[model samples]
Target chain A: MSEAVSALNGQSFVGIVKIEEAGPQGMITLRGDAGAAALQKAARDVAGVDMPGIRGIAAAGDRAIAWMSPDEWLILLPHAQAHEGVATLRTALAGTHHLAENVSDARALFRVTGEPARLREVLAKLAPADLHPDRFGTGEMRRTRLAQVPAAIWLDSAGEARVICFRSVASYVFDLLSVAAAPGSEVGFFDA
Target chain B: MLILECPCCGVLADETELAPGGEAHLKRFGPGASDDEFEGYLFMRENPRGVHFERWRHVNGCGKWFHAARDTSTLEVFGTYPAQTTEPPRDIRDRISARRPGWTWREFA
Candidate 1:
């Protein structure tokens, strides 16, 4: 294994919202016919979890999967398991019209948790998707732009948002989130 | 800022999240067609004052391409539909007719 450090290694920001890298997680991009039973079985056999439905996420132990588009899903797993996971999936899906790429190095992930209302305000400024819990609660995922950069966002069970952006723009996303989470920077409705 | 709902994902995508795809339901004039036919298909577009149909892609959302019907003058959206069909859906046509009386665009009257 190559010794590749994370983009924000040894760096973390804290304020009303705490921002930090989610460690080294494996990411895989899965694309296929969602309704096909064979694809579903293969995904479950390889990832140890059912593929998530539209705008939904399914978590099984250490692995989690998020629905990105109609026929696309993002699978997150332990770094050590990514390689084996991809090979297993490829074999399982042999002769099928599908693609399973190991995107572990393509994306950077951050976990953001804080005052719900404050976090909502910050996300609203960057993304157009409604961050209100009623609209974007747990299990729901969206592929949207954050500050002109493409990202995938979703809330965990604890209401903490997991923001994933391309590795190339990881630093920019981190800085933008830090600025938004800074003290006294959160613009309340009355202030707006 | 115009917001068009993506029929596939049901997301009300903002103009920034969506990419405009010019006119919708256009027929192609390929080989064996007259020069005028090909030219018309390639360049000519219906720039109406009201009740226009166009294509849009939810670039930052579901990444699905869809169609939207709206009035060019007022910016009032009639509705959005899937891109699989060759023309706008019946329900969207009815909605446009209800809003703009006696408007004619394509086969919809």
Candidate 2:
């Protein structure tokens, strides 16, 4: 608990709360025209992974998670390997009909793990992401607003989910989580 | 809140995420497109009262713009699809079955 408190010191906080050390996670936003097959191919060529066909998320190993869309996808990678991954993607996608932006430093991540019901209840306060089995199942990702803040939610195969938001909004969101995680709650940040 | 159903992100977004573009399926008249055509393109709106189709841009969610037709009276959204696509959603077959007495789909079109 003291360690957690120490980690969040001097960071922006509007209310009294506990903070967990969220280790680095790499986030990259990709944009392009939907008809750019060459860009898609370039993405495949760079990542050595095919894009997910469904309107959801596709994870390739522990290194990255790709959220599919008609014209864009947000790729999240492990902290240490982010630079290499982005560099490789940029290299492979050079001259292609797409743009890849490395935004790893722009976002903050929080892990919410516990009994499914508790997490769901806390999330219901602000999350607009559908958590139903038919919608956001395991391995699925949603880009929606939580407490009016743009957030990305992803559920791992193990049912552990992570929510990523802008760094400026992290403290406010963390306070909301603290209120939600009231008594008998075990919530902490992940140290990368 | 105005109900907006996006074609790509499915039917779940607030009116805050959408910008309405009046009526759908407008025809361009004339070669240079006269002032009337310009008026049709700029100012004229169908002011539909019943089942009407309109264009909406999903500004916040998918960022892809699309079209949606809905009944203002019943609030039943019949169809929605990508704006650039030629064919709209096929589910409108049963939705437009019974038309309102004075309001015609042709008037809104």
Candidate 3:
């Protein structure tokens, strides 16, 4: 196997908030009914996190699960364990008609951190999602278009968010974040 | 600035977040279909000025396909529903009826 490197080699840019490429992270895109109890159990057993409800995400330590759509859920775990995670899920859901794929290498992950309102401002400028503190808070996930690319935004904490987009668009997203986070561009709409 | 609700995830997404999928409830015509029917299915669309039903993909959100009923001119959304149904639900049809007074989904030519 070829040597593994993150999409951006841990590129970091600072402006209104710190924008950095996340370390190698494992992601499994499970195409199945997220509402199914069997699927939920399999997800929880693998990630040690509950299968999140629609637009919700639950995480425990380095493992996490998020609802990407009514029929799909995303499982996040340590990079080294991704393949094994797919094997375990496939075995657990043997009779089910489902698709589980290791999407870790197919996507890029990044983090934006400062504070809730600051983080919201950086992301809300690009995504159509309402990032108002009252509307989108921690644990909520939105799969929306960030600029011209399809991306998913997870409000992980009051001061941080996880942004994931296709590997090819890493620079595009990184640049967008950098420009949005420029010091003078702060639009504290949510700070009110 | 048209906002549509995704019945699959129940998210009210902006039109920019959703992809318009032409017309909804289309009866696909295959190899054995008549030429006019196939052409109608492929090329024709109802240009209703009032109530209309159309397909929309919540491409940015849930990534699911859903159907929406709305007014073409005024942009008053009647309702949205899962794309699995072949016809509009009774409630949505009723809502459109109440809103437009005499609107009925026109039959395909």
Candidate 4:
């Protein structure tokens, strides 16, 4: 059997911000009425997080729910349990208008970790998203263009950010982040 | 350089984040219609140098289509509304009227 490997083979870069491939994530694309009680329960039971508000992301331990669109959410869980997670959600929301599909292998993710200000500076160079700590904080996610590839980012804490993009563009995004986070390239744009 | 609000995501997105979708509120003339009507429908578009309605997709934000009313020359956006609405909301129309009195774009005045 062919074993699965992370898109970048766990490549990592140490700079102003530590950029490392998040190996083997369990992701599910769940589409439904975010306000529906059934969905709220299903997600809470499965991911341990309630329905996030607009552009909101809530996490508890290894489980998370991210508001993707008006009616879509991305659920994150343990890498080994993605397929089982989808079956559980579909069974729970069977009667409702909903969709749950495994997307763990279809996407790539990276964790940018360092001082909050330095991490924000690294992202600001490659994305147009407002990186001001006051404006964007923990529990909020922004779907925006990173350099040129479409990517979504969320700050789990003041010092760490998680970025996700299509699997095919993982290397491209990694390169962009590496150059943006290079030690001397710091523009100090986000330093308070 | 233009930043427009997306009603779907409720965010002001940069022009680079949006994809222009041309004029909005076009009446479709299908196969049953005369050639002139179809030609006008397919080819004729509002090109007023002043107030105009346009469709835009927030490609990088929420990925939803929305409408924008703006001045062609000045690039001043009167307002933006959700794509589901058939016509500009009263406030958007009234705002344009207040700023550009007697201005007409297609059937809107």
Evaluate every candidate with DockQ and list the scores: 0.69, 0.36, 0.83, 0.74
Q: Considering summed lDDT, which 10 consecutive residues are worst modelled in model 3 chain A?
A: A31-40
Clashing pairs in 1: none
Candidate 4 per-residue lDDT over residues A1-192, each given as its tens digit: 257788998899999889999998999999888678998899888898887889999999999999888988999999888888999999999999899999999999999999898998888888877778877889898998898988999998898999999999999999999999998887877777
Best-to-worst order by DockQ is: 3, 4, 1, 2
Q: Give the higher-DockQ candidate: 2 or 4.
A: 4
lDDT of 2 by residue, A60-155 (tens): 765454654577877766655556766776777678777787776677877776555555555655665456545556756666667767776666
Name the regions of candidate 2 deviating beyond 4 angstroms: A1-21, A33-49, A157-159, A184-192, B1-5, B14-22, B26-32, B85-94, B98-103, B106-109
lDDT of 4 at A117: 89
Off by over 4 Å in 4: none
Give the TM-score, chain B only, in order for the candidates: 0.95, 0.69, 0.94, 0.96
> Residue A128 deviation, candidate 2, in Å?
3.2
User: Which of the two, 1 or 2, has more lDDT?
Assistant: 1
Best by lDDT: 4
Candidate 4 per-residue C-alpha lDDT over B1-109 given as tens digits, one digit per residue, 9 for 90 to 100: 7889888877678888899999999988997999999999999998888999999998987889999999989989899999998778889999999999999988877
Task: Pick out the ten consecutive residues of candidate 1 chain A with the lowest summed lDDT.
Answer: A183-192
Which wins on TM-score, candidate 1 or candidate 4? 4
lDDT of 1 at B79: 94
TM-score, structure 4 vs. true: 0.96
> Candidate 4, B13: how far from true, in Å?
0.9
lDDT of candidate 4 at residue A72, scale 0 to 100: 87
Error of 2 at A187 (Å): 18
